[model samples]
Target: MTSSHRKGSTEGTNRVRDGGAVHVSPLELDITWGGDGRYWRIDQDRRIAELIQVCWLEVNGSVEMHHLQPNTRYKLEFKIRLKPDAFGWNDSPVYIMAMPGKGTKCIWASADLSKIRKGEQTCSIPSRLEFTTPSSSVADDKMSFGLFEIWKGRWKGGLVIEEVVISKV
Candidate 1:
């Protein structure tokens, strides 16, 4: 797959750190759901970008974006709320499968972050997620990119997501 990138001070790719040195935004997201309420604006929360100091969202609901890199290598670190025992706020959240409509897939997944860290290049893996890029994750002939279009249940009273980060390999 080609390394599709957008250059500019875009909403989720800008990072000015340590006296104006701009670093590439290695992480991005469309956080439609989480512990906090959904916010359409980028300046509202940190759950939006788990790493690389980019855009973040701290809420719960639905979010959608397009032009995701297709049939390629990628990495995502997410701290998702797991299925709490009989709790309404429980969230063993599964990232909304970014299938043909989004041109992507999920290859691997693990709620454990330590394992994901073995190959991650930047940022620490979150202890709350299991992610993958395999096409057979949910259904055949499909792929899952960490776009987070859907979240199971709600983050009514707990920390929605501790962190989330993603990169195209």
Candidate 2:
């Protein structure tokens, strides 16, 4: 956790791991998935979830962001992987979005899940997502921050989400 205090941003005494304050949180047990349990599976031992296949794509999980320092530059990252037998990522890129406080931001990633190698521990290569947190304000003191998998009408699947991380950049 590197110190996230921007040069001109507000500062406070909130300790974090790594260089800045970094929070690595595993996904919750009850993750919101599309098509109920048909399209996804949870590996309780590894604490990760895999998206098998579905007509549409939508996966979401949230965590409290109160521990985030005000006015600090933070990146919300999602740890993911692509299974060897995965499909449907070559046609179009998947959309990843994060909502911090009252603001939201979106980013795009390669749809080619086949290119990613498998991880030794989990049998899937690990991928990361980094997005900035919304600037804080008095009114939006209560912020619910999380990552979501959203794509347009298409066949989307084959994504393994291990965890979500919030760290100062």
Among these predictions, the greatest lDDT belongs to 2
In model 1, the Cα lDDT at residue 59 comes to: 23
TM-score of candidate 2 against the unseen true structure: 0.62
Clashing pairs in 2: 1-17, 1-18, 1-19, 1-20, 2-19, 2-20, 3-20, 89-111, 119-124, 119-125
List residue ranges in candidate 2 displaced over 4 A. Answer: 1-26, 29-35, 103-115, 118-150
Worst 10 residues of 2 by lDDT: 4-13
**How many collisions per candidate?**
29, 10
Model 1 spans > 4 angstroms off = 1-29, 33-72, 79-93, 96-102, 105-155, 160-163, 167-169
Give the candidate number with the greatest TM-score. 2
Q: lDDT of candidate 2?
A: 0.51
**How well is each residue in 62-126 modelled by candidate 1, as lDDT tens digits?**
11222223333444444443222212222343232223323443343323222232222443434
Q: For model 2, what is the error of residue 151's alpha carbon versus the real structure, in angstroms, after optimal superposition?
A: 3.9
